[model samples]
Target chain A: MKSLKALNNPLSTGQKQLDLLHKGTSETYKPPLFVDTIEPTGHFPMKAKGVEVLQINMGKMCNQVCKHCHVDAGPDRQEIMTRATLELCLNVLKNESITTVDLTGGAPEMNPEFRWFVTEASALGKHIIVRCNLTILLANKKYNDLPQFFKQHKVEVVSSLPHFSARRTDAQRGEGVFEKSIKALQMLNAVGYGSGDLLLNLVYNPSGAFLPPAQASLERDFKKKLKDQYGIEFGQLFAITNMPISRYLDYLVASGQYEDYMTQLVDAYNPMAVEHVMCRTTLSVGWDGQLYDCDFNQMLEINCSGTKNKHIADFDLEALENRNILLDQHCYGCTAGAGSSCGGEVV
Target chain B: MSKSYYEPSDLGKFGDIKDFQPELAEKFFGYYNSVFQEGALSEREKSLIALAVAHAVQCPYCIDAYTSTSLEKGSDEEEMMEAIHVAAAIKGGAALVHGVQMMNKAKDMSM
Candidate 1:
């Protein structure tokens, strides 16, 4: 059996990219293991406890081509959920006390059935979170009304904004992406998505080699500046750490930042932040309905237990709850410093 | 002709070696330094860009370092937050365009 790493080759770009999907920089660049004697600068619990948030990967259809995406999501991917799989999800939602439904993908909105799922979840009174890539709203005519749609259904908009500068944003994404993202954000604001008192949330992750700043303090700064400069009002700013996976690992390997970056994460590992790690409370569902310990694990193809049904169709809350987490060095990222997730600081 | 399947994951072995093929790592490091160097962009500017690029690429370590570096280099909160959207857009768009491949294949098979 080929260990996934056995399949990689530095010379081939395609192989390199695929390898990145499974072995984020952590595997290759060995960071010092988190030693207990060193007092952790930031606080987080040592072990993770499960929470009731239900995460679902709608599909792999997206509109942007950023460099660091972990999903390997693109327009060509066909691994979408069938109506049957979605039905299984709804059944679980009805029976389970799950409070949050997190929808992801290559811009989950690209799914043909995205709205149907969102509407169904809303009807069930579940808090719906759409991990939106803001520019999608401005890419095509079909997506023009997404802000209105999200607002109408009261779906919490967890959108990403890499930075405030046009040059930096455009370089990472493409030429005109900054202008378009701003337009879409303004649209969301117009529809009350980011206006004060609205439930709109903007996600922030660093652009380069380190952990994020303290979430609360960062959010304060974000709120004030966005409000003052662009009049872009958002409810909360989530400072998530970028997990080393997929294209990102490729970027790290290609640019030789993999080792130093991994070292930084391991050095910053804080056990106190572990308890609040999103994986403890959240169960990530893949596009094919497979169950993963967390989104990062899913990308690595580490599914729930050997005997359990990994797909959503086979969702068993009790069985999943009993399964131990699948962890690795990448887990350090979630436990470092103040910790990071879609909701800001974990600890 | 879209190569369709180019993944960096193929290069996993390079990182596994205790002492990497220094020449190779050096090459990558060189490109990296060049990417972040002060040219049209300042080191501070490059750090912010790197932070957003880190998210676009999804490297947790880069995310951790660049986030702090960006802030340290005077990137305000709004600026850093905005950089993430840039990553999201490119990532999302990359996924969406692959649909063209699917569409082409579907059309070819149908025709």
Candidate 2:
């Protein structure tokens, strides 16, 4: 892992990147703005329908630097949720309206108090989701029992396995990631995690600059390949579109695919998908307890679109619900094609 | 004014053909739309075929459009490139097969 300061310097200087995106959205190559495209469908300025899911970005400290990671999470990242912030989240969960807690991070498991937070959240009887990177469970001896811990809590584990093949997965993520991820999946399966009662969902984002194949078709391929090759099983597979932000944005710019990719996203905007976007139902809590409409907005540092109650400490359900979700060019990623969200295709 | 045989911007204005011959343009567009629609072949399968034809005909506009279309329709790079190779094989084979005509003509002349 590189030093945190070194890894984050580019992000601090990323205003140029943002400007490039802005130019695309506002000037040349304009398809209708994402918000405008949805307005006629009565879904513009997208508001939270309800807080059914509370997605907590535990921190930016991750075990690997995946190329398309919108979180820009890597081993060098030092951001971790403090116990105090976790307590605030737990307090919010007491409301019962938030029925699910979706935990994400560089690797949510890397947080020192991660299990404690999960244990307490599970006691609330709410469905719990952990966006596991798979490799982290195999990264260290202390973290090896993550599968058992998750099973005990009955946590729904959603992991990224970009492809079932080693070459593609390792290309997007780091070297040997696919092998470690397979081992982690087998370990989870051994504990009955992928079978009945325990839900082990695998996430697939494209390895290059393209939308994922239809979730149903891709899931069949994953099921056959994983079962035939490694004798693995899982409940569901989620096909996620790579959000054009953070490391992926950097890749787009560097590879000269930024404009074309954004054009594709804008051109493929699906109004039907706008109504069910994750941001409509999920409140993303950042590492420091700040709030955003979704995790991609959190990475771009776009706060929730409101004048008040922008942090978990100041969480007011009514006020938060009434606030308009922020809009930007990046919003196209969520609305493109079949529509994309943490749960996979919306439409 | 400046002049060039092919203007990159012309691709975006493809719909503007209606301004000249409205009925014919409309008919052409209708035919084009129907052609791409699913029939015996799926839209994805058609897009792959269009991509292969784009390369064989060396039409930059078709190449650009069908490449993106194929991707949107869920074709991976490997499959898409393989489609191009299929085009390449036929193209190369067509030229080589014509050599038999030249061989016969040369033998006749020499005799």
Best by lDDT: 2
lDDT of 1: 0.72
Model 2: CA > 4 A from native = A1-10, A13-18, A24-33, B1-111
Each prediction's DockQ against the real complex: 0.03, 0.27
User: Once all C-alphas are superposed, what RMSD does model 2 give against the true structure?
Assistant: 4.0
lDDT of 1 by residue, A78-162 (tens): 6787777887888888855688999888788888888898899899999889998888897789989998888877888888776
Candidate 2 structure quality by residue, lDDT tens digits, A1-347:
34323556464333544565676533556555666777898876677787889999999999998888888788778889999999999999998789999999989999999999999999999899999999898899999999999999999999999887787788889889999999999999999988999999999898888887678766876898799999999988888999887778877777888777887788888888888889888899999999999998888788897777589999999888778888878888988888899989999
Pick out the ten consecutive residues of candidate 1 chain A with the lowest summed lDDT: A1-10
Query: How accurate locally, in lDDT, is each candidate?
Result: 0.72, 0.86
* Best-fitting candidate, scored by DockQ: 2
Give the per-residue lDDT digits (tens) of candidate 1, residues B47-110.
Answer: 8788889898877667876877776554866768888898888899999999999999999999
- DockQ, candidate no. 2: 0.27
Query: Which stretches in model 1 have alpha-carbon errors above 4 Å?
Result: A1-29, A33-48, B1-111
For candidate 2, give the lDDT of residue A113. 96
